[model samples]
Target: MAKFDLKGLLNDRSVPDRQQDQKIVYRNPKDLIPSEENFYNTEKLERLKQSIKLLGILQPLLIENRDGKDYVIAGHCRRKCCIDLLNEGNDKFSRVPCVYKTSSELEEDAGQEDDIVRQIMIIQANCYRDKSDWEKMTETLKMENLVKELREKAPMEGKTRDILKDLIGTSSGQLGRYHAISTNLCEQLMSEFEEDRIKISVAYEISKLNKEYQKQACELYEEAGILTLDDIKGLYRQQEAEKGIPGQMTIETATGQNRPPEDDTEIPAETQIERFYESTNKNMKNYIIQEDKNMTIFMLSNLYGTARVRNGHLNYQGTTAGITFNPGRVFEHELSWQSLAKILIGKYGHKKPIKMVSVDIPEKPKKKDNEVSGPAKCITGKSKSGICGAAAYCDTEYNCCAQCPDDCNSRCGWLEERCQPAAEIPDEKQPDFVEEIADHPGEAAALPVMKNNDQRKEWLRNYKLWGLWYEDKNIGVKYYKYDFENGACLIAEEYILPGTEWMPEHETAFLHLVGGPEPECKGGIPKWTYHARYYKFPNSETELVEFLKELQK
Candidate 1:
């Protein structure tokens, strides 16, 4: 029997030319509806550059035919890079391959054009080339363009509904949040939000207040310099107290404070939604805790949704995540919460719902819907598996699928008993199985935990032991070493004590430092190693010392 060469056959296939009979070859990136966001964070750009470097002009720059030349369609970044390369005399810059694009080119005049597509190319570039503060401004412009488009399309029928779905590859809900930001906030607050001193969601909330009241709130936030959501609530209380209201749960204290409403009449629903958005939105600000090669997680909110952690860096799924408890950002509004969850799920893996502390006191809402259910949830002895964790890790291990008699795969947290917390084990530890997902057995693979390409957490623990380990109750200290392809694996900094034995069970070499009091390198071999050689990273004696310092701190 003759065997067909799949790889050779596939690679050998030619890209046949498109039909050009009487057909009008559509040319313009403006016509295509992108399937995903052009999130050009650093990693993506490197890939694009590598591709451009490796395979010159494989994909053409899509453009609309304008007066006999190509008017760029979707690959703006490639165009810029082409120009850059040409200016630098790089031969690869001569020609770029592209797909003919079709988009609502007319929308450019009507305010509903294709902006994300054009921007992604630049994102594709900056993600690896060079990033500046202008990226933030670029994001602001993209956000403004979307707002304008929403305003134009929103008036026309059948648009708002699309905002809920992945329309044009953008989360319409997140777009709506960006669009709604200034509409619900004031100029001063908006400006502060741009500087990141205060939060966008918080500004949105204040925007809901009367102009005069919003101004007053902005003044308070600026004056405090360091502001918390509770501080804003306190200002609200101060206003009520000035009005001689009896008592209200406010920022001054957890206990009921003296603050009376001017009138018992309800606040507007618009006002309530705005307040909810602000409180929840402040839960994140581009913060990060760790970085490896495989993933990047943004734990925007605390376990119970009270606060947010802005960002984290990662290369692979470094073994840290195997033991690390990174949570998600939660918000008050249903859409934002869902959208944040969606992005989190799509990007990093899922998380566990955090149990928050409760106020344990009763308070009336300024609006009817502003009940305890509105702002935050206090997690007691129970925990909810994070949205992704629920779908992946939690469900399979606890036999949660057993509850869905008809369909185990369905999303039925309410109807299925297994969807809820398990009774057999503590909610926090119930879904610890990474293999339960069956697809990515090396939960710690990305974390550089798979030292010898063997699936186990033991290597990661050993790696952790290579350096000093310190846990800060306030700052939450965690230490790790892994690849940087995901984003950040800080081995470039130091390696104080790589300990004593030189076991070479694996193909790689090892060293055990003689000065350590006890045997540090007790293990035979690491499960995973990202270095060309272990000696490479701990390059200088000073860096090694600093690594030890991080361990103690």
Candidate 2:
């Protein structure tokens, strides 16, 4: 018998696809050594079992004789099925057909423990099996190592991926992505991916994060659910930006070398305002560290700034430059704000005591919700009762009282029996802000200088602009109007209609003020629901700005 053409047989170009010993013989199903690698999924394996239970082993198992033992190279599913049937008292499956490789056909070095030929032949035999992305990744990675050994052992003619493209039937680019996912993703993330819990694209994006961020992302996924590509990318960017700050539980911190002071007494943080300037040293602003929590959380209640180290100074930009320890650290001792500030200066700031000031805290304006805002009006023409009127609350897309006519673009879904016409509803209300601002001119004049979007957003909320005007370089200009006059503020995009100033379109978002308005109900709680395409109730103006910026991107 001639030497077995394993490579030619794998590529399907050889005449003899089987070993030299062609005679098929019956053997004990339990006696055969099962291959450790099985690529068939559970459903397919079940189907294979059913097929063998009815037809028996139609195809003989391709067996390799290693040191007087029969090892299965193919037909693993068939042999397992036969053994299962035999266990179920079906004596017919006690013996199964198999074709064994002749001793002369075996390579001289094939008896070695880590024989590369055996590994390649095993993977190549199941190349056509249905496999998940994770399975493909794992198998391809194995093949990559084996192929590298093969190249070093006997100089291959093509690149590793090219050789793999022929051997495993996976693309080169896909193989690269697989390698990246295998190397970068945390073990928890990899397990989730293996079970098909997380998407491949999302997993690939998460693979770009460092180990700490990867662990964080895995935790977020387990807590909140699977994260999207955008979420992972945002996390990656945040990790990149915070790299200079340290205290991300590095080696020293993790080993407790960088632990806080011994005294754990709580100290009231003193308020200190420092005159800080931008990178260009122009447009100086006052940055105040109002309070601290565990000497870690330094909140700039009235300011927001991005801090960075520049030219040997703890430089910062924006009005709210806050200095504090990283919140992720676990400290045993509590330190005063002054002490924490000194530590910050040692790391990223100038070695000097911060300037102090006794500025008066401004009083926040109280909101009156039950004042003059009218009810939501229906736009879907006459209801079954008569002409549909304004509703105490127009049902949003979440729960529609009635099937809307125009996809509820008007954000109105009042049932015919429930709502009346505007003529009968009779909304008689007065403006809340015009009179107050007119009376307190000094209070109105004390508005903060609108230097950034954060300040501008604060101005809008304080003065009650009832709208958001944003100008983007790429998107040109866009405006979002708040319909506060109608119960809950139905945030909608307003468009100019000929001579009309602005007409509100469908509701894109909404804001329900703490003391905003009361709904006049005929029955049931008013559901001011619309198909909130996107909605977020940010706790602060800075957060709102960040959310809007993400939307623009």
Candidate 3:
């Protein structure tokens, strides 16, 4: 019998146009290099090992040649199992079946094009394998980079997301959630999420908090065995509330004429870029722009998106929006730092107000004539001029200043704090009221008829019956019809709507808010007008009652 030429067979398999019926050949397990990437944990790896021992390599491995080495591509775990069995004196397992991948079948793993193609192949090959959320998220992020490159290299192929969807079975919305979770959540929380201890939706919300707050939320979850949106929101509200507490030291307190300084030492001056980077990194690390190789990557906080700057061009992608801009020149000025930030916000802010991220110095608060009286103790004994000479409190053990005296020249660092711009409240427009009511609902009489705008606003503010409220407890209703000439107030105690994947839209009562200035006809005959809107949220009294009950528990 003619000797079967395994060498010739393997060599023939490397040819691009080789026969379709490629035969599998047995090779020493040591000859094949295990794949570098490993997503399986020890438990899963052990299970794979046991399965291999039982099944005895029923399926052949896929191998590719790279730099004169046979590298395992799809069957990393199987190759590992063979090697383990061979090490245990199982001579039968020394040689395992593998099919050589053709040159045309796999990319050369060189250059950017090769890198993207290689990632797509690996992701598709492992699609059948059971993966953790973290692993899927990791693959999704890799695919995101591949999508960007593919778009740049082949702009006319298709939409970026459609290409990504083909490469990896993930929607654009899901990719955003994965990106947010991976970028913002702390390591502990991420691990918990990966291990299935936390839900992805809950994890995404928790990612909005800083690392410290994430850790706190994680601890709460551990104790309670459950974490909800309300819990996460409560923690967020607590964090924001701590920022502007009453009597708390403000930027004004440090630099004010009568407020004590944090310390007598002078802080070194920071450049605009350094200041912007430091403040953003400290407060909102997710939004902090990071330098990578020749490009910079920045996050769009409001839009939950990301963008990159390279070669004097900007490329941005978000959940609901995308943009590309080329200024024809690289930004080199200090002011360009802030200008660039504003440009990103303006394009992707989705009509939201601007974020105060620039390094602009805040205006100092005006002091009241009777805000403080009498001589105060200086907290820092060592002032810029000399020793502070306020009072005996300077000599006290605390050595802290109760307040800076009127004549004290000590420079306060309070002037350095970033100030949020005052919220702009637009003047309310009065609605044209109809003199006669045509078909007023009986409930319209129950609602107080306010004569003026202030009374209307006050009523809306005090309204606890049903309305969209702000996230912050102190802030009142989000939507109000101040100028509304009430035509009807319909309340649905129970609602049945189409259910979504997440949950039903409304299980509780909601308002069928029908109030707005009726469309007017300047010179035409009178006709009844009805402006109706639906509010399904949060505006429910039953929900609030249930929430309060849960809080009491």
User: Which candidate wins on TM-score?
Assistant: 2
Stretches of candidate 1 exceeding 4 Å from the true structure: 1-51, 54-59, 102-159, 163-176, 186-553
**After superposing candidate 3, which stretches have Cα over 4 Å from the reference?**
1-20, 37-43, 105-112, 154-156, 192-199, 218-234, 240-553
Scored against the true structure, residue 445 in model 2 reaches a CA lDDT of 34
- The deviation in Å at residue 326 for candidate 3 is 66
RMSDs, each prediction?
A: 34.4, 23.8, 32.6
Best by lDDT: 2
Residues 1-553, model 3: lDDT tens digits: 2222222222343322341356788888888886665454434577777788888887677777789988876777777777887888888888898787654422332224665555555565666678777778887788677657645653334565665666567898998888899889888777788887777878888988986788899889889988888999888876655678776554455568545333322211122222334434332432332212112233433333343333211222222233223212242222233343543233222232111111111332344442222122222323321112332212222211323333343323232122111122211221111111112232322455455545544444454444322111111112212112233333332323333332233232222333333434447832233334433322323323322232223
Better of 1 and 3 by lDDT: 3
lDDT of each: 0.36, 0.50, 0.47
- Worst window of 10 by summed lDDT in candidate 2: 352-361
Alpha carbon RMSD to native, model 2? 23.8
TM-score of candidate 1 relative to the true fold: 0.27
lDDT of 2 at 81: 81
Question: Deviation in angstroms for 289 in model 2?
Answer: 58
